[model samples]
Target: MKQEQFLSVVDRDEAERRFRAALEPLGPLGVEEVALAGALGRVLAEDIASPVDVPGFDRSNMDGFAVRAEDTYGASEQAPRRLRCLPEPVVMGVLPVGEVTEGTAMAIPTGGVVPRGADAVVMVEHTRLDGDHVLVEKPVTPGRAITWAGTDIAQGEVVLRAFDVLSSRETGVLAAMGVDRVGVVRRPRVAILSTGDEIIRPGTPPLPGRIYDSNQVILADAVREAGGEPVPCGITPDAPEAVRAALLDALAVADLVLLSGGTSKGPGDLNVQVLAEVLAPPGILAHGVALKPGKPLCLAASGRKGVVVLPGFPTSAIFTFHEFVAPVLRILAGRARPARLHGGEADGARTWARLPVSLGSDGGRTEYVLVRLTEDAEGAAIAYPIGKGSGSVTTWSHADGYFVIPREVERVEAGERVEILPVAGVRPRRVDLVIIGSHCVGLDVVLARLAQRGVSSKLIAVGSEGGLAAVRRGECDAAGVHLYDARTDSYNTPFLEGGLVLVPGYGRLQGVVFRAGDARFEGREAAEAVRAAAQTPGVVMINRNRGSGTRALVELLLEGTRPAGYAVEASSHHAIGAAVAQGRADFGVAIDIVARERGLGFLPVREERFDLVVAASRVERPGVRALIDELASEEVRAALRGRGLLA
Candidate 1:
């Protein structure tokens, strides 16, 4: 078969519009009766009204004597009133056998039925038992210590409404109403199919040029989480006949069909073709979507049933499934959409976060950038991009939430505000202290010490300049910086503004890092090796990100000459070491600690003072105070020195 081209490409919103339009007026598949014990997580099909009053009759709320108020009106400790004690006592779940008439009383326990002529119950402590009579010392009022019928729940009152998800609390209410079985909306059956010639089931011995089918496993659980019953359709090889058969079998037993792979414009892409032949009217409403990580997604409908073809990559498949298919499945299963997706700002489910780094986007497609959220010193959210591409399988697991970049916007600047859409119904957890700036192993030591004192902190590595900016904006309690000012020939202090206070951190030796045993850098003076590497032909050098202290040092060393890989920037010292050690680049500037950890050859250039720039207003805050105290502690200082930092 010839390679299939996309018939149409629409933006994400337009694609969703066409897909939902094809399957309009969606609702629950049907309702079914489920026992109360099995109703947890099921959506109620209709309102449940109480069949009878909670308390069938007037009952006693205390273990005391039941008597008319007038009979004990004048009874007191000084002068007591005597009454004949009835032989029969009221017991729980049993009807009272005798009546207390005129100057007579009967003992009744809690939840015991109240007898005729008894309007009140007195405490056993207040009454003294005699041979044939009881002495009442406290006055009694009519209807005291009594629980009237229907007091807890009235008859015919709606206790639970339609579409309410049954939890322990709701189930307890249903049990109290004597509802053993209840009607609930049926969970939609979702058919999951993973198609590819190179796909193999997990646990089947390894094979060359083949991968385990993880899409099915993830999609199945995702369907269940979205209130649908997953029906695994197994793997289908890249053949028209086999693909067609699998598609038919899936549709035969499912309300929705989800197939990953074979939707792109490759020669092996035949799932969309098979869907085109099998789907009824309004088939293949959208063949392509203008979205990053999910542009090849296809949405369709066969009469009332929904069909979706997700991208082949694991991250892409799951992302598109949640964005497009999960909402439809939730609607069909009688569950409401997540409040973060549709609710207003007042919902408390949404948060606005500032990006710590600028992001470049593909202007042709709307991109959703996954981020890890951390709170600032002022309790504001800071979003850090995961930066892993869509093909990666681990990005989704570590992401806290994601923010959207519109197709018209090509870049988002550092510290720009954006609304964060929470993932899996999880909101950003607030932390006690927020530390943003350059990263160092010594900072980790101090943070660990603070943790022992029950203090929590969040650290965002955005280079020295970026961190200082965050501190100036009042977004962070402290910033770690090692900036060297050429004018003053000093570090950190030269960059501090009036409102910022410099806290003594530690000193780290910054040096040129190269692969161990590289003759060009081994056993040479730091200045001589740097000069030799800069002038050497065909020598590639990894550069630090702009605004970092190391970047400034790099520029000074190069003397206005850009190397082969000068534009390729890494954000952290560890990344630089890794690049040099792995042969991605010949050399980069990083801390000596990273060189030692990654087993790279290091030529020390100079020791830079790494200090914390604290916001003066936040210096007295509890978390900040704890962080300062930890920094000054002997244990923390010893740990920092052990990590090759001069404390």
Candidate 2:
């Protein structure tokens, strides 16, 4: 079988233009009458006007006596004025029977209809009852303590406009207008299908060569989040007949069809082929896009109904769905588009942020880098790239937003400003503490403790040297460092300069890590194991990134011998342990905590001091003070000790 190639590869803007042109003049599907009880989260289909005036009639706002204003105009505590009191008392929800004439008053409850000839209401506390007459001690003005008819809501006034989303507040307004039902736009029905021979249901046991179908679950919820109803069509195999029947069924029952997988340029990729045969006029607007993580996307339409084929990769599928499909879904469901910040129209759904490190792009494709947002000491936003590729499933969940690199640009220099677009449904918030430095598992316990005390923190792992540089620039409140000084033979104190304070943190046992049963490293000393691994042929040893204290230690242990896989540098201790545990490398250096966590064998080298370096100007910050206080607490010390750190 021959692989089917893309009909055309176009830029993102051109692809979006072609797709929208194919499905022009999009609007809501239709309208339906829904009870007010079930109207939450629904968009109004038509303008709603009040049926009757709110409050319906003039009413008293407090429990008081209704009387003519002249009767109480000159009344005072020293010289009380007397008035004749009516026999009947006014009750709530009922109209008063008698009128209040000159020098006359009647008892009225709150919310009771005001009687004719009454111009004001006097509080019961200010008046005294004497037989059938009332003595007024306080002065009153006309229309005082009274709510006039139609004052809250006037009749024939539009209360809600079309396309307004109904919340609790909106529903309350409709209820006050005596409306039992409302006309709301119908939710668009979307059908989701997953295709692949390697796809299996989530609850089933894992097989040797199969993966669970996560795209279906992700797309189903995403459709609902975009205000569309999802109709799930179960997974289909690679067989042509099975996929064709599934596509036809989905098209017949859904207003839009989404098929993930089988859109790339592989012989087994046949969803696009099947879609081309079924779509009507103006079919297959664009087959491939010039964007990273979403280049294999295919867009098509059957008259007004849209059919999209998403890439099989989770990140690619989700990115394309939001960039292309979500906007159309919002229009069909009568939902408003998201608002962009002022002066950002050219960037389109993006805001400005500072990138801390340099990044390289593919040059041929527009790359979107997912980032986690944090703040500097001066409260400016910084975007740290996640660095995980498109195949990673956890990137979407962990990312705060993403920034794009254009196809023409190949590299973004450090400290360069870039425009970031927020992830759907994620609102970035300012954190209380910003810690930039090496990653540690024990730090998680400390941050968790801070969270219990209502402090939010953001940690960026950029190595010890980078963190020290950031501290000098006042880019962070504090930085965690574990730099070893060869001259002074100290861990962190020797590295501190003027205006920088050293906060004693904890010690971690750095060691050589390997698989538990690997005979080459299990029971040997740290230096001996490292030397043996470096000398042995085909014994791969993973190294840490430059500027890290662990990398310095690795260089010392290697003694100038570059072993296999020495160039493969990882960013964190966990990544080093993962490489050795997964057989990607024979040995690596990490902390004892990581080895214990990953169930790997450890040979201790030396205990390294991990301490905090604080900027002198930011030492008095509330978050920094709180962090210092927590570090001195016995609870934190105990927790750190439990996690294999010497606190």
Candidate 3:
């Protein structure tokens, strides 16, 4: 058989688009009617509007006399009012026989229907039974203690929208809406097939050079978590005929099919070839992806069925399933995207977090970095990078989450954040403080102090301008900014907009950072060193992103001459240092603390005031207050001064 191969390894975005396009024709799974008691986790196929009011009739919410509210008006213990009594009180299982007229009252119990001419119910405790009348002591207002018709739920109101996953709570809602059986999307059936000859079931004894199948169990549970039904198609040896037979069986009973192993280009690997030849037209959509662990991923579709060829290695299989298969399964199952929890209390509910250490990756390919999350001594959640080989299954069990490094980024600096999709069932701390803006070493110190107070902050390094824009749009609680206004010769305060209060932060020593012992900076002053470096041949200059205060100063120092590698932009000051330290560039602009940490020599250019700008209204909020107090505290100052970056 002719082996099928990838046309080109596409990036994550293009891969997603192709998968989505292929699955678009599958549409929603066929609808099925499920009893309310068994509807948990099922997605609704139709809007469930209430057919009738929940109570269905006007009823009493309290055991008291039902009378005109005006009769009890101004009635008090000191000056009691009396009303004529009815022959009998309102009874359960029977409506009131007669209405209470002026100066008349009737006894009513909880859940009893209210009679006509009565607008309120005065509790029995507030009234005393007399020979032929009841004496009221407390005042009662109209509609007091009375639950009117349709109070619980209104008729024709859409209680549940289509495609809503039915939680236990939602099932209760359906019950309340008088829906006994509901139409819901059928659980997507996922067929799993292992196609390697060296694989055996878990119960079987291991043989030399052979392993038990773990992908089936792992992938099956993953499908269940995403609201799909997994059907194990059993294992097939590495043969074209066997693989093809298993796939056809899977396609017969499954909405989606996953064939593990046999995807790589080898004589024994025939899953890709089978998918291309045996599957319906538009056979193989993608044969490979630019994904790190799951680079050998293969995708195909036949009519309404989608098939994915997964790598045999457990770690790679899991990663590929999560990154590629889970999302499409959710679409077929009609699961809505989970909402992000807001507020500090839900801080442990976010899917991703800030990277505490720098992570390096090759550009142009999406890399999934495995990570383990641990709370530091201060109770702040920290994600430590794990770089075990993709073939090692232990990496999956050890990882709390994994972060996807984009194709455009080569390195993520310490304190430069990333989103971490947790392992199937892991929950992370909620981001207590959201700071979107310029990255600074001094701010990192302040964050460390906050961590000591058990507060977690998420920092996004998007330059000073982006931070300010985020603050303006109310996207974040605060932003770290150090924008230098050339006109005013001042920093952050000059560029402050309305609704934002500039909190004065410590000044940082901005300078040129270069590799140690570089001859260009041996004795030259800061400005001269920069000019010399720019004019020298083979000298590469790394720079911070435009709109950064440090970048502004670098431009000021450059005057007009452009340097080699000027087009290369680093996300943060630490990134600049890391770039130069790694020999990716000759020199770059950054702060002193970061330069020293990377063992790079620094030449002081000027002190830039790095301020924290917050929404004026959030000044008293807990996280913002902690940030303000920590920044002004002596501990933060001492830590900052120790690094020689504090002013």
On lDDT, the leading prediction is: 2
Give the alpha-carbon lDDT of every model: 0.80, 0.81, 0.76
Candidate 1 displacement at residue 94 in angstroms: 2.6
Worst 10 residues of 1 by lDDT: 337-346
Clashes of 3: 5
Tens-place lDDT digits, model 1, residues 236-280: 999999999999899899999999999877888899999888888
Model 2 TM-score is: 0.52
Q: Worst lDDT window (10 residues) for model 3?
A: 337-346
Which pairs clash in the backbone of model 3? 347-429, 347-430, 348-429, 348-430, 352-420
- List where candidate 3 sits over 4 angstroms from the true fold: 1-7, 203-208, 336-647
1-647 in candidate 3: lDDT tens per residue? Answer: 45445757888788777877776754467799988888987988876766755455556778889887778888999898899989888999797888777899999998897776676789889999889899999988766776544444444434565665776657776676678999999999999999888999999888999999999999999999888999998889988788888888889999899988877777788888888779996678887888889998987888757889999899999999988888778767876322222322333344555566578898999999887654332444556675434432234544567888899999999766677676554444355677877866567567766754546666655578877876775556788999998888988988887888988888888888888899888556899898887898767787676778887888888888787667556556655665576564678787777676657888988888989899887788677888988888888889889767665
lDDT of 2 by residue, 282-332 (tens): 878888899898998998898878999999999999999999999889878
Error of 2 at 194 (Å): 1.7
Model 1: lDDT equals 0.80
For the record, the alpha-carbon RMSD of candidate 1 to the native fold, in angstroms, is: 31.9
| Sort by TM-score, top down from the best | 3, 2, 1
